[model samples]
Target: MMSRIPTDAIRACVEHTGWTEQEVRNVLGNVIAETPDALLEALPEVIAWAKRIEDSAALVSIMKELPRGVLEITWNGTEPAIRIRPSCDVRQVPEGWEIVLPDEKRHAST
Candidate 1:
């Protein structure tokens, strides 16, 4: 069965990322739909990462692809770069960035 994402989490994402409630719900809902077990475990991390980037579009793009693969953030450059990669293909995550959604967890790379 699919799990419902917590409303509080949605609200937090909206507040932190400057995205509308609907936008937060849409991205999170899609992710939860794809991975029922990841709801609670992934929500906090999602919000934290969202707060690090000022680009709502980029964050949305990252969240949308999370369920399909792994999310990789690289902060070594002048600006953070986010991307998605197949779970099986993830390498050692670099410094200043974390990899999300690998194996049991899922989400991006570049």
Candidate 2:
């Protein structure tokens, strides 16, 4: 699999979607600059595809229905047909329990 980021493709996707180019760049500017063209092209397509089915309400339903478990993505070697399954087992973390983490590990929280 290619490991480079596709800057041009990402820009095109952002532009096509009417999102501010500067905002997207501000978020992924550095990585996009270093990404491979092929990867960049693929990334935008993936984003567009994801947006088509971006169902926050469905996600909330899933979370409510399976409050005890976690969602797992099962890759099927396809470009955009990945499956997300909720774990059979309940969440490892108990309800009402807070997870502690170091301040340095705060990245990706958003």
Candidate 3:
């Protein structure tokens, strides 16, 4: 069965990639910086197996991205599917994860 995706999954992915968050952040920033208009929305429900399964290697086995938004991830863990919405209430943020709300339209950057 698939596992649920947790905010901590970000760190797991970091560990699996053997890359620091700053590095990944920089890479992603560079890739998306030029295309700020790009909306790379992820279902996350697909790659959520990492939450229940502790083995990163095995986790990678069932991790597969079917499309830009859909993922087909599975592992020897319990990753129950769930509904994700942009307008949903925010869950508690995990360690090392920060929830940044979009800037107010009326407020200018300091």
Best by TM-score: 1
Q: What is the per-residue lDDT of model 2 for residues 24-110, given as tens digits with 9 covering 90 to 100? A: 544444343334655465566555554555554566565565323234444467532323332132234656433333333334232
lDDT of each: 0.61, 0.48, 0.38
**Which model is ahead, 1 or 2, in terms of lDDT?**
1
Q: Which residue segments of model 1 deviate by more than 4 Å?
A: 1-3, 32-37, 48-110
Local accuracy of candidate 3 as per-residue lDDT tens digits, 1-110: 01222436546656765657664344344332223323123323322333334355554453432112223233446654433324323346767433333344113322
Clashes of 2: 5
TM-score of each: 0.38, 0.28, 0.23
Tens-digit lDDT string for candidate 1 (1-110): 12366677667777877889887766666553345456667876766665565466768776785554455567876766766655545446656445554445532333
- Pairing residues by index, what is the TM-score of model 1? 0.38
In candidate 2, list every pair of residues with a backbone clash. Answer: 4-36, 5-35, 5-36, 6-40, 68-91
**Higher-TM-score candidate among 2 and 3?**
2
Off by over 4 Å in 3: 1-9, 33-110
